[model samples]
Target: MAARLLIGVLAVSGLGLALSLVAGTVLLRDYLYGRVAEQVSGLSQAPDVRPGAIAPSRLCEVTDAPAVLPSDFRLTVIEADGSVRCRVPGDQTGPPVPSVDELRDWADDDAAAVVRDDSGSWATSVDAFDQPGRDGGKGYVMVAISLRNADLTVQRVAVGGAAIGVVVLAVLALAGRMVIRIGLRPLTDVREAAREIRHGDLSARVPPGKPGTEVADLSTALNSMLEEIQRGFEKRRESEQRIRQFATDASHELRTPLTSIKGYAQLYAQMAARNTGSDAGTSIAREARKDVEQRRAEVVSRIDSEADRMSGIVEDLLLLARLDQQPELVKERVDLVEIAHDVLTAARAGHPERRLDLKVEGPVEVEGDPGRLQQVVANLVTNAIVHTPSAIVVAAATTDGVAVLEVRDDGPGMPAEVQHRIFDRFYRADVGRSRRSGGSGLGLSIVRALVEAHGGSLECVSSVARGSTFTVTLPRAS
Candidate 1:
């Protein structure tokens, strides 16, 4: 690119220099030729020549001739009889005499002509005069000044101008090359950055250019695009990783329940087979059957409980999938305080020994799906009650044009790191304890998704041993 730009610059500059040199040379040559013509015309009007009276040997002598004539100046006389005589200043041989036909062609005294001969080129003019004693016979006086000096001067100027033009072009090419390289440096940086990005280096960036220049604007635009692309790649990678982890966790969770169900079924089958093959008295067989029935009942109850747990996990997973797809929600005005009250009431009934409290500052009306909002309140309250041994407080209020619901517990709170990923599906802070307590770990995840779907946000503030507070903020009903 730099080379192309440099070439373009040189081409334009060189063309301009060439045209200037040509024009200067042409103007100078014309001016020089005009000056020579003027000199020849002045010399032609000199009253020095009397061709008929001068002897052939003394035709070159002229008393009235300019004493300072140029050494290369020549004079020629042609009498009526077609006799020609030529004379040059300072003994320099001049151009050959003009032929009779050529002299006849220059019959006008005011006309000037350029004549070239073996000696050199000359600017020549002719003046006709009648001889004092001749009858209808005229003599011609011709004056010529050499054009060699003018031509040489023009030639020198042309050559010199061309040489200077070449030098200027060379200098311009060098300077233009440097300027083009510097100007295109930003583009070079951008190309390298793009190449690096293509090779999987997302952090590479183009160097900045001068403000308000086209290259700067381009750099800014390309940088923005690269940043967006990098962000997109990061998000995609993170999503894939989450999907893999989710699949693994889901499989593990289902396997646990399936393993228990399988074991209980096999035990039930063994108990039945043993009873059927027993060869005993009727009372003994009857007692054996009663015991087997009681054991089978316990086994079937456990199997049902595992199946219910598995069903809950599947249902939560499906709900998350739907939320991920951004399903349309049933939007309506719902009172968050009422939802908190109901969730607290259920908690109290479920855990009579544990103290649960509900605080309502106001109606806290918000626009959202009622079922989903209630579920959100229930999940947060349940999580507090299950994780903390202290009394749980579920509160709802309207603050700053938004409906806020907070579930607080004075228990062993979590660390900052745990709070950050608490809403991740199937992520448990206390994995063993959560599994033993039949916690599916999808409760908080579902809560977050539901809140976001309603154009709300969920946040958890926690610190070890102090307390944990889960706050959900939703837009107030308008």
Candidate 2:
């Protein structure tokens, strides 16, 4: 862009100089010749000389000459009948005057006027040498003037002027380029800062440059974005550490209770089995057996459910860690429609009571990690199944330029507040209900992370008592 601007300036400057020079030269040449012609005509009228014996008139040679610049062109005067009296180029070939077609073309064929000589250097005005005190009067005396070397001087000036113009233009263009670079240097800083950020240096920031340039504005914007990213990562790291610590603490706290319950239940079962032959012991053992069985079932269920919940949290943490380190490989394109079909098939097989409808759109394909994409779908589906445990409706659609994979359920949906935090780890809308249903709240968060890793987004649309819809939108590769 800078090169183009500089070249345009040079072109405009050259055009202007050439036009002005040509116009000024033509005007000056016309005016000078007009003045000389008028002066010569007056002199001829004053004194008439028209006889055979031509007498020399007292002509103003240097005195009548106009004030010419040092580099002005020279002129020579001669008779039309091929007799050279004075020469601009100093007639070397014995008195035959120089002839010029260009000068001849400008004047009428019969009309005598001051004209440029053949050498293109001289202008000549012929004033007839009228004999004042001689016979019969009205005779002609050819007044000749020469100016050949003067044209050479004028040409040298023009060439020098053009060369100086080119040198000045080149110097200005070079200086302008340097100024442009210095002004936009902040852009380079911003670009390098972004490069560092991509290399996992989240703290990298662009320094703002001096005022009033695009580069300064760009640097500010980049620094703002970096600040936001840095804050988000700091919060995420802190949350991850807390989650890991919480999981460990929960495991330790629950372990002792689980062991005691299982041991007591097992001991009671043995007692019931051994005392079946005795009346008192058998009656006591029979009641103890019922209590023990109830306790045992409850303890096993809690342990199993809690362990499963903890395991999901750990898996989610691992996935986030992997995502932080490096996203999944998008080495190959995957047919999104094909993966949607598999998810639908699984849903149909698993939930026979619920209607799982799969509507595949046209050739839905994306450039992403297939494994990650499928996992994103499965997570949404699982969320739909749990929320709207029955009547699952799985559908796929592509609109405009994006592919949307949805897992919808026809059960009661969540409120606005609950829905917002649904994706946050372990954030259950109904704590008691989630506990009863054996749910760990890391499912949707994991789904969000996985979907984002595939360069996709997740959204939910739900209303009171109405069905909830989870949609995954990804860019379809064309």
Candidate number with greatest TM-score: 1
Candidate 1 lDDT, 1-21, residue by residue in tens: 788888888889889888988
lDDT of 2 by residue, 1-478 (tens): 5567667767887788777766755565555555544544343233322233222332213232333111232333433443444433332221223344323432222223543544443333333333456564432333222333344444565676677777877787788778766655676677788799889999988887667867677778778888998999999997898679556544543454456556755765675565454455577767766665676667567657656655655677678678766564664788878887887788768876767777776778788888878888877777777666657767777788988888887788889998877776656676543345535566787788777877789998888788788888888777
The list of candidate 2 runs beyond 4 A from truth reads 1-313
Q: Give lDDT for model 2.
A: 0.62
Model 1 misplaced stretches (Cα beyond 4 Å): 49-58, 61-69, 81-83, 89-93, 96-111, 117-120, 132-134, 280-291, 331-333, 431-434
Worst 10 residues of 1 by lDDT: 48-57
Residue-pair clashes per candidate: 0, 17
Q: How does model 1 fare in lDDT? A: 0.82
